[model samples]
Target: MDLDLALVRAFTTTAGTLHFGRAAEELKTSQQALSKRIARLEELLAVRLFVREGGVRLTEAGERFLPAAHEALAAGGRAVAAVSGAGPAVRIDTWGHLYAPMRTVAQAAQALGPVRLEPGPGRDWPSVAQALLHGGTDLGFGRVHPLPGGRDAGLTQRLVRLEPVDAVVGPDHPLAGADALRPADLREYTLWCPAELTRLDFLRRFADAFGIARRQDGPNLGLDHLVQHLRGDAGCFTLFPADAPLPDHAGLRAVPLVEPVPLYAWSLAWRESARHPLLDTLLRGFTETGRAHRWLDYAPRRDWLPDTDHAKLAEGY
Candidate 1:
């Protein structure tokens, strides 16, 4: 049978403690199992390793073997470190809101070294800012909300894209059949904006620009849930990013509101204190990829609008 490092470590630890009961408790194993393993080690080595007269005690052979067992364990630890490439690894955390941009960052990180990408659900903007300042994450992606006047210092924010927010509706709706729609065109329709919509600067701007007031007690659901409602014809409309993938519902259609308002913005955020070589490489990779793809050159394929400014829309908000 092959000698296992775990077995060796177990034996060594048990031998040091002398008392099998105490060693088993420390290792979180039953005394019977610990004794079996100890017996196996002794049998394999062809020597009696311990004495159990009043309390457990190491025999002559065990005394001679302990130093070699410890040295082997230490050597095993070094081998593991070498094999695993053990070192400081970058941990990047992002909110679910920036999934696409976070994916780009994750791809860039793959080319660098070991990276841990942590995706969290909708976190408030203040928690995001605090995470960066506290060195809780190497990088983050989300909408750029204005920081408190004094708190804006010591962070680098790169505006990546802006996506136009539009009202999504069903095919039977009057506006959905129109060639184009304006905020006034939607006045009579029931608007289904999420509760979180008010907190978003762009969504608020769109509402303000169109003079459309949110319904007082409408269904306050998430983006995906609202999309379902729109498909079911439960309500007339819900606000969504023009570039976002529209759910394929037979009755669902998205109409660009006339006089486009910024609905969403995306940014690459990092702290001034994090001056790692990998960070620089990651930024360069993202820039080169963005420029190569000309990500802004394409328009949302869901609905083709002749007069729609694809370039402006691609500036992903």
Candidate 2:
């Protein structure tokens, strides 16, 4: 009798985790259904793969079968991906046209082969993250880097660059010449935070500190349009990271915010199980950038903030 690929995958996952419940959850299947698959697998092989007493443990035959199982599944996955055009082709998410300054680190991606860097269809961080979780993309660079718990299946977030929040206003605006700003100084102006970016954790946290709320003033709130409004009498202002690329308009200026506003950073995220060379290349670019001195000095690993690759961000991954 031929062994089933599903059974092999279930066996491998259960063996790797040594827990039926976790393996079932990882496989996105029910425990009962998984147990039955295991039973079928043992029946076909005529060898008991697991022994359950207090908890699951692999049998000698199971240990012997593990390598073959992994090889078979990996081969099958490669074949499927090749035919389906889903992998071996790196697809990473980009926000409009924003990506962190990698300090010549992006050049290393050439060693990994072709990359397809594209924007998420929804044009928001949430959509980008959701696409990565559901296998729509291999990696993502976004503003919102929430934790991997809840419905997300173990997505990984790596902070690449530390960027402070900057408020941009027209050259003629009253606050344009302030040189620096504080939370209290922003009370009078209605800040225009795009609906798409309000979900960023640091932005949301800092906005709450100043009682800033989400409001779109006009039809075009993109980086280009927002700057035009700053050059006009829009009676509004917008926030962006210090590292974000702005249009080459002479009348626009991005001012630094003084203490008390939680800072924001650029993050690269991907699935924990996604082990592509392209993903590793991007991770290395962010990790090996040698920018520990630039890390956020204050409570960087705060609980409320999303999972960050602090070790990598601070000490190279």
Candidate 3:
């Protein structure tokens, strides 16, 4: 019987990870596609290779077939490499182009051998997560929600930074001349945002915690549009990463938030089953850079973080 290499890869990866979702992510295919390939392979062999009980498990036939499958995949990879000369570049995606994480990614890429960066996937982390799981990108960087056992869906994440945040206000705002403002100081002003408060976890939590009385949402056309809104209303303000570059507008000001400075958490996420060769180097670069620049430093009493983030950091994850 002639076996399809694609089918064999699907089986081997699924077998190795014992998780169809993660296997599909690593193979850069949909789970449905991976399942069909496995079923096709079973049909060709006239054997039930797997048993679906409480979860997926391999039958005796599947256990017996695994070693041969591994060998076949290794041979296929060797065959491809023999003609391809060099492997393909690793692909990376990031969101929040105007934030500090983008700069961190750019700096980390310098340590990689050869890589392809696909930027501006979306404005937030969920978009980046979709790209990772759908095989659109090999890796992604952004804020991450804590998942059970540090794995979510078919992806894994590692905390990379706890960046300090700054408040931006109109030049004519009452607090504009203050050297720095605290969360409580802004309680009387409106927290202007581009999305519904329910959709913005960090900002919503901040408002609730600080007893900020009002929040207003509007279209997020771009930085310029948002700045125009801020400038027109002395009672409105917004937040950005401390290192984010603000435009040179005469009426916009970036004011530091102090007395337990709010921090934005940045993370690197990838498919749990992916085994990219350069992933280690890429992560190491972030680690080394973070250490050199004190990117991960957190002072519990002097800094502010989301409760989940604070717990994760305390656990050293």
How many backbone clashes are present in model 2? 1
Better of 1 and 2 by TM-score: 2
Q: lDDT tens string, model 2, 16-105?
A: 678999999999999999999999999999999999998999899988787568656656766787798876545566653432333223
Best-fitting candidate, scored by lDDT:
3
Candidate 2's TM-score: 0.58
Candidate 2 local lDDT, residue 85: 89
lDDT (CA) for every model shown? 0.59, 0.63, 0.76
Q: What C-alpha lDDT does candidate 1 achieve relative to the native structure?
A: 0.59
In candidate 1, position 39 carries an lDDT of: 85
Per-model TM-score, in order, reads 0.56, 0.58, 0.70
Which model, 2 or 3, shows the larger TM-score? 3
C-alpha RMSD in Å of predicted model 2 compared with the true structure: 10.9
Cα deviation at 48, candidate 2, in Å, is: 34
Query: What is the C-alpha RMSD, rounded to one decimal, of candidate 1?
Result: 14.9
Return the top candidate by TM-score.
3
